[model samples]
Target: MSTTPQSPAPTGMYTPGDSSAWSQRYADAVMNTFGAPQRVLVRGEGARVWDDEGRQYTDLLAGIAVNCLGHAHPAVVDAVTGQLSTLGHVSNLFTTPAQVELAETLIALVYPGLSAAESRVFLANSGTEANETAFKIARRHGGADRPRVLALENSFHGRTMGALALTHKAAYREPFEPLPGGGEFVPADADTLRAAMGEDVAALIVEPIQGEAGVRPLPEGLLATAREITREAGALLIVDEVQTGMGRCGAWMAHHLLAPGIIPDVVTLAKGLGGGVPIGAVVATGQAAHLLGPGQHGTTFGGNPVCAAAALAVIRTLRDEHLPERAAALGRRWSEQLAALPGVSEVRGSGLLLGVALEEAVGHAAEVRDELMDRGFIVNAPRPDTLRLAPPLILSDADADAFSQVLGEVLTSRTTREARA
Candidate 1:
């Protein structure tokens, strides 16, 4: 496939004139959790998207790092469409070739040294579901008497009750109080994590790179120490790679870069796994793989054939195209350019997953993000001083240069205006 960038379509599939009608329909039919739609995206191809106003924007966020292959890639479309036409779904009562193959692929990717039989997979429909399943498996592994779980601060696991309890944010957890019993927060330090673990603790769940926390990569040696402490305490170390897996962090798994021998007992994945279609997986190693048994956990839509096919396609595409290596090279170049820009205090993260921090808290990261959108770029502001960029792994040097130029302009202009004021 040619990597040549494509121009944005002359017109969008939707129009701004229809915004009110669409907004009304969304308000009446959809839930209010996400508040208002940013812009009614009409269509997309590769790294570009068109909004309701027919304005085009380079998709730097990649649908929150879900569109690994970019919008409507031929591989994803063909896999999903072909699978849907052939066999859409068959519940857990039966298994399909794609489902089993996807499980094997994930196991190989997550635990390269482990055998397929040694690592079992339980597929779900989203990242939260994957974490939810891992939580249940941990609880079961420690038996009914042991239910406690230790989670790191500034961590985000998921929103479901089980996953929510493990999530560290108070605001997101407090509203849905009395979540599952036995989940505690510890500082991301190894000592704090060791201090929190006990015999009754079932697991220590953590993100190798905390995506929602402005892409904060865990400090060196912390993950290795956490693994040792969890094993000593007989607690499972669960790595939530939901946002960091599938070559997003320049490796098949971000933890691989930190600690080579640091394999977690349980690994949860989602986000870019299926390129865009929803697919979540929990891969368990050693005895943890068999803890769930026959009837301990299951999902209605989990491991549906169509979703599995999509995941297989994504995995194959990553390997065939050697995207992980590409991501590593591009990430280094992009981070260096970003750090060279004026007012850019630091650039942290691996692969294309990066957080650019400014010298001063420009209370307007969001405002600047909006401006970037207006200027035909898409980025995200996870915090007042931090801007995250998780573009598609397939993005080319030209795309990286374009993003750097626009980002430099945005930062320089903002800094200059603030100085004037």
Candidate 2:
């Protein structure tokens, strides 16, 4: 039979030879949730990525702050590979050394100087899952009388049913109607937050730095005030540190930057915890730690050994490399330099997590993002006028300086063109 000689089997990775072919395949095979594929990324190392056609770019978003050590870090790869060969997974009915070790590590971070017994961890697989666990804890602590939950106006917890209720974006929440636990959205101002902390409020969930909301950080003492207010009202305080935790915010947790004596009842973490491996955790302290008892809440693959091992490696690497301190220094330098750019209005955020607000005359943030991509940079424009940068913690000062120079050039060109227009 003249079997059509199957076109000589292609070599190397399954790249369609160009981005358009991959985009078409993605449109046909994948869900359109995130719109069309931006680029068919093929490989990455450190803070850089290469697309299907071999174009390289500096990855500034770091998979939305999930890649703390950047892509293909040896620590993460070794941990994951070694753990899988030893013990890939064990159901929640049993525990592994890696699982316990990671939990202890995270608990230590949550309550430094105290025994790990002071806190409890429930591991999940994503920030949304962690937030969902925290939501259930709130309900369990609140019981029937306390039905109301509080969240900030510009907050973004997650997209799951329970987390969706807490997220303040109308577009994200409106479509997913009748979300499971009802919650009230309020401004992050201390006075408004205090007023919202009534007896019926089950819990007040807040992000130390509202990442999706243009990287807007809460006023320095807002979290501490939330702690006091929730304590007086007998309500739980849940801090969503999904994007700001794991050394992304110049500290182990962004809440650490808040005023002293700010202890959140429950803290949700994910994104960078596993250094790109999927993992999330709800670390509960004080009475909240005891709220979810045996058989109350569980996940089958939540604390799988492989993911735990990866997280432990990530933690060790962060400390060994002193990446958090590096992030702080680079963040300050870039913030100052970016703010001085011609078409930049302001810079917001802490550490490597940052947002640059463009002057109105500079045109749409989407256009700027495209221009940056064309010039070998990848960033996130979460809003019409804002560009967010959550580069890998390993980003070198030279890369930061390079970004600044390119950004200055782009801004100056845009301003000159806009002035003429």
Candidate 3:
């Protein structure tokens, strides 16, 4: 008598092999936060993916540096599927072996010199959420005495309220007025940072290598200077490794790679931790580890068994395969190759996380990115003049060489067009 579409509306079904139809359906059902879908990707494997129309692409962006192991890696797949079948999930009231092991493993691996007693891990659902947790810790640690937090200009923490407050971009902050407040932006320089440091500061949060700001590395010794300043001022130093961690920059954490022995009070991590599965972590050390009391912070699905298992598998695979060392070697060689391109001005960043700076006459990064897309390579332009390539750590040398050739062709075509015009 009653027909409610049986809980599966006609519009709910997606059309096979038709990107247009899927796009229409997506517009009707999904929010327009990310605008139209790029290609309606169907599946992926080993740094490559196919869209609904069957056009394939080499995923050089690697889901914005989140797919470190590439798409559907066997280790991640098996770990996720197996653990999901066995334990699946449980509330924070209880703990799973995977959860405990993941926490321990992160401390042992990422914070090598620091002992377990001196460090702790708090897992969350995304880099944003992990940064949110860190924000709370900073606030709690500072209390009423220290009210200010420092973030860099052009820095991107996240979109959430707390994290967004720390993000220094006006476009992302102005619309959302009266934010959590107390967040200030400072230039990434030792002198500027020391001038900003004071007894009123709670923490100075920074990305050792600014990923969104065109893969820019902070001036050498700036972090060590920050370490000394924050220490002397009794403030916490939070390193955000969301975009540069888990071997993306040839090390477990970019801070360790850049600063060596200079340890921070807190380290926020995500993106590549679960390879592809959603997971994030906050690594706090020394007295900073005990800042958040029991009931002060928690997450519903942060370190659930299945996600934890996936993260554990990712860590194990990265270590076993020596992927970090591979990233360093391959990235250096490939960077030199890209830097040699006529249109490229500079190749910034280290290891696999690189941002290629484009020359004025060659064309803006967006146009070049589109050209690359047409040629079956997927990359993104975070800035007008820069193209970021964060291919999976498993990227083959042959693929890297092939990509260089394709890029050469694309730039050459642009050059030819300009000359004709």
Q: 43-106 in candidate 2: lDDT tens per residue? A: 8999999888888999999999999999999999999999999888779999999998989899
lDDT of each: 0.87, 0.90, 0.90
In the range 275-338, model 1's lDDT, one tens digit per residue, is 9999899999998898887877889999999999999999999999999989999999999998
For residue 301, give model 1's deviation from the true position in Å.
0.9
Q: What TM-score should be assigned to candidate 2?
A: 0.96
Pairs with steric clashes in candidate 3: none
User: Clashing residue pairs, candidate 2?
Assistant: none
All candidates' TM-scores? 0.94, 0.96, 0.96
Q: List residue ranges in candidate 1 displaced over 4 A.
A: 1-20
Per-residue lDDT tens digits for candidate 3, residues 344-412, read 999999889999998887888889998899899999998999999999999999999999999988888
Error of 3 at 111 (Å): 1.4
Candidate 3, lDDT over the whole model: 0.90
Q: Ten-residue segment with the worst summed lDDT in candidate 1? A: 1-10
